[model samples]
Target: MGASGYILRRLGYGVILLLGVVVLNFLLIHAAPGDPAEVIAGEMGGATQEMMDKIRADYGLDKPLIVQLGLYLGGVVTGDLGESYFFNQPVIELIGARIVPTILLVVAAQMIAITLGVGMGVLAARRPQGAWSAFVSVFSTIGYAAPVFWTGLMLIILFASMLPLFPVEGMESARFSGGPILYALDVLHHLFLPALTLGIIFLAQYARLSRASMIDVLGADYVRTARAKGLSERKVTFKHALRNAVLPIMTVAGIQFGNLISGALLVETVFNWPGMGRLAFDSVLRRDYPTLLGVLFFAALMVVVANLLTDLGYRLADPRIRTGGSRK
Candidate 1:
């Protein structure tokens, strides 16, 4: 299929997949042991039987499961995710307020992981027995082994508490008022630790995978031909081999996008970052069904979109895919 046709096909599939996700998340979340009305009533210091019944009715929790699901699906179709039972706001509004921070965190983490990981991998692959290779191997091992929350805590202790080089928790300095540039700088400063904590594990995986892929690519006949043509070692490795090697990395990165968002739950909790992770965490604690469902829907949507983008990227990176090799 042509590029346009290919993209349209993928998008068609994405819509169907998203619908399935919505139903599954709704069922799974409702099936979990909890009563939203009870949680809300408890927060209000308790309520009478009539009050609890009214609460349930108001949130439609009194309805049959099928009715509730039908109603939710109807609302979702109309761009209404219902109001947050705990936050007392529209779920969409709540998500809008928090999504940007999560996006920033995720994007920043991906960039860090990809840039450093690919660079280290390339360096190591260049000299398989050199000191840089040894360092990359050890770094990847420890980084992959460390728990994300532990990494965040250690970073906080080393940088925020002991050395005091960065803010301990938050997306910005509360008291500081400044220009856009300075504000951006402040956010970046707070972002560094959380982003690093989230990215480090992925960085290790990328480093190892890219190193292996690069080494294999370097052994290919094309690379040998390039070397025979008297191209510089740099040109042979980077201009030819690296481009092809990146295909697998892109595939893995796209697939792992979901995991990155999920991992943010722990990272954001530890760092006290005001993102979807924190929002989802709060929603779970309060049994806020609408809010939780909204988060899951959006997270699933992101993963689906990421996969589509990965397919497009694969097509762009490798001409064979674009020219009808496994376009489906």
Candidate 2:
């Protein structure tokens, strides 16, 4: 297959995967023990049977499960995600407003993870039995093992409480009114802790993966041949070894991007960051079905796209993996 054909095939599979996610999410959300109508009714003082019936009718909750699912799928075809009962706004609008912060958080975290992880991995690979290597090993192990929520708390205590360097909760300080540059700086200032909290775990994984990959690549025949030809150590390590080793890292990084988004749910809750993760947290608590379903659908879509990108990255990283041979 040609590149276009390969892309088309992947897209087709992505659509099918997304449809499956839609059905599963719909079923799971419906299966959960809670009535969205009841939650809304509780918020409005108490509800009579007539009031409850009206509320159910308003949101199409009175419809048969299959009929409701059909209606939802129809709405999805036209780019409608229904309305949020609690927010009194379109689900799409609610998600659109909050998605940026989440994206910013995830992207910042991934950048930190990749840069430090690859650097430390390369360093550790260069001197496997050295102090830095041992430190990397121990640090990565702890980082990978530590719970994300716990990491956020520790960062808050050390950075926010003790040092008083970064803000504990929020994407930006509400009191700041300055130029765009200063505003950007302030946002980054508030962003540091949360991003760090989210990134550290992934950084450990990347570092460990990169270190293992680099060590294996260094032992390969091609690397030995490059070194035997009197190439500089830098060229032999980077140009020969690191280039080949980076493919696995790229694959992991792509998959981790999706996991990072999911992991942000707890991180966002801990920091009170107003992102989709926080929205998701709120939706679950309030039994906001529309918002919850919308978030799940978007998350599934992101994962599918990430996986597709990873496959594409494979072909780019290794020319031997041609589009025709990669079709599945």
Query: Largest TM-score belongs to which candidate?
Result: 1
Model 2, range 1-328, lDDT digits (tens) per residue?
6878899999999999888888899999999899999999999999999999999999999999999999999887788999999999999999999888987898899889989998899989998989999999999999999999999999999987689999989998989999999999999998899999999999999999999999899999999999999999999998999989888899889878778999988899999988999899889999999899999988888788878888887888787687335522
Candidate 1 stretches with Cα past 4 Å from truth are 326-328
The residue pairs in collision within model 2 are none
Per-residue CA lDDT of candidate 1, range 274-307, in tens?
9999989889889998999999999998889889
RMSD to the hidden true structure, all candidates: 1.7, 2.1
| Candidate 2 accuracy as TM-score | 0.95
Best by lDDT: 1
> What TM-score goes with each of the models?
0.96, 0.95
- Candidate 1 residue 141 Cα shift, in angstroms, is 1.2
Q: What is the Cα-based lDDT of residue 264 in candidate 2?
A: 87
